[model samples]
Target: MSGHSLENLASFVRDLDSACSALMIEGKNLFAGSHEGVLRCWDSATGDLRWSVEVAGPISGFAVDNNRVYTTASDSLHAIDMSSGELLWSRELEGGSDYVKASNGFVWATSSVYELEVADFIEATIWRFNENGDELERWIITERPWYFDLHKDGGALLGLGRPRCGYLKIQPGEKPSHHQLQTESPVTSGCRSSEDCFLLGHADGTISSIGSDILSDSDSNSLVTDIASLDLELISGHDDGSIRMNGTQHQILGSIDSVTLLDKDGWASSWNGSDTQITILGDTTNTISHNARIRQMHSSDERLVIGDELGRLFFLEAEIVKRRRSEIGELDDDENKNSEIRARLRMLRNR
Candidate 1:
């Protein structure tokens, strides 16, 4: 650990994987689905290869639930068992499935909108499926949904696109309700921070929070620093750990080019332009540099994992940066309490 600590914990480079494509971090297991059509899982504890499997090429999306890993490549959706890495099911979708989400007993997929050759127009399809592999409903969206996140409290799903953005609320045994949000410049990325509040990244280098209140000046601003100057959303990372966006556990903001998540120590790196600098959300002075521009970024509790087009994966771990937060002090999430529980679970995995 570095002696010069920010807030409480010093952020340091933990490890690097020279070979990487699409990456996901679930608990202590880090999953990488490469453009080479290969998927790998590593034991984050020892940085050991837990299991590796070869799959079809150019994976566009990767996700995980309690039991399995869901992936999309080409127009196909594949589910692999979390423990054994065995293929449980695979299905093909119309057009090409560009994004996917699995949560609250349902799996969702969306296809790219623009024509394959020309980015001239937008037309896309969204598909929903149940655990038994039965197709529930498919809807068409005028603006493509490039990314999605499950509402933390459940009963709803969040979707993002350039021209439009919205959330679909699903009630038990009832039709889902969808609502559209207004945005100037394209809404490149979005994620639900809490039940009442969500954050969105816009193409003009801006991130905004949309909650029950529609007219709060504090809701929108150019907080992305260098990224704001270069309206790009290159890669995205999901909040699957203890890090809080903007110091609150529920607030998460994202752009299309780079994955942006906030925390007490600042933020995990996401990109807006060709630059390779990772900005700490509020602390613009502190940044970790990379040789290549970041194409994808993901996170665990303490680890920020990023992949570049150069086929390399870089990782940074902030020593629980939340420990140093002044006003908030420490993270109030269950991570501290769950550490004892996960320690016990780790023992089982070793066997």
Candidate 2:
């Protein structure tokens, strides 16, 4: 364990009109979608704006392949050309599109309908389409899926809710199969660690694995809010403002909002009303606090991208972050300049 410190600050874009709701990083590009329905792409290395586009509604999620980016806005799924940011096609889905993933030359999306009278999601549908935006198949389920991941076989693995209380497996052009678990809590978050391994977290703070022999059951006594995996290591965030890495618990500032992996290290972000904290887990753990709440985060290789509630986007690199922390550690005892340095180290772009 290492002492927690605030240091890293990187390039940022602060012109968004609403909170950033979704983020994805691929290759040299960083993609962000906002609550105001604005989607923008930036060069991950230079922080230069590549393009921006407006869609039908607030962007909920995004999926990117080699040539296209697919996003779910309102009840419609929009496909945009990756390079030019031109709209290629848009298709309306019943209920509302909540999640989207692209793999193996195909796209998969999930939509759910909420029953206001019951105050819960009543049904959901899984849709599959080709790269050309043509629908191929769909399967409807009675329970809403709390989480889903794309399987290596080009199918969808869904963590289901009440009545099922387990998982569902949907293969391409085949009938859906399901296995019910005899548990009181539903799966809340999950991630595909490898081609053959999937880890799932439950509301009762239990962690389970499918197809992996290394993971064993662990309990945290709080709801698992998010999970991210790299190779064989697993990092999970909980509702109790704690993070578990391979069953080792680390305390943070607030309840965790999201967790992700930048290269081999695991990063978790949490919000406690006035500030947002981003903690890195590895050989030497570090945490950075920000003024704005982070809405979404994603990473690629050594680079990290963050979208915050104040509509700002930040880009940081692992080596640069370490270097910045080292620079901060050498500051002198001048109060006035130290005050300015602390402001800059908050990681918010000074406007």
* TM-score leader: 2
Output the number of the lDDT-best candidate: 2
* Candidate 2, lDDT over the whole model: 0.79
Residues 92-153 of candidate 1: C-alpha lDDT, one tens digit per residue: 88776677778856887777655758664377766778855688877766666533656655
Mind giving the per-residue lDDT tens digits that candidate 2 earns over 159-236?
A: 987767789989997988997654557888888877877888888877777775443455557888988887767788
Question: Where is model 1 poorest over a 10-residue stretch in terms of lDDT?
Answer: 226-235
Scanning candidate 2 in windows of ten residues, the lowest lDDT window is: 1-10
Cα TM-score per model: 0.67, 0.87
**C-alpha-based local distance difference test score of model 1:** 0.55
> What's the TM for model 2?
0.87
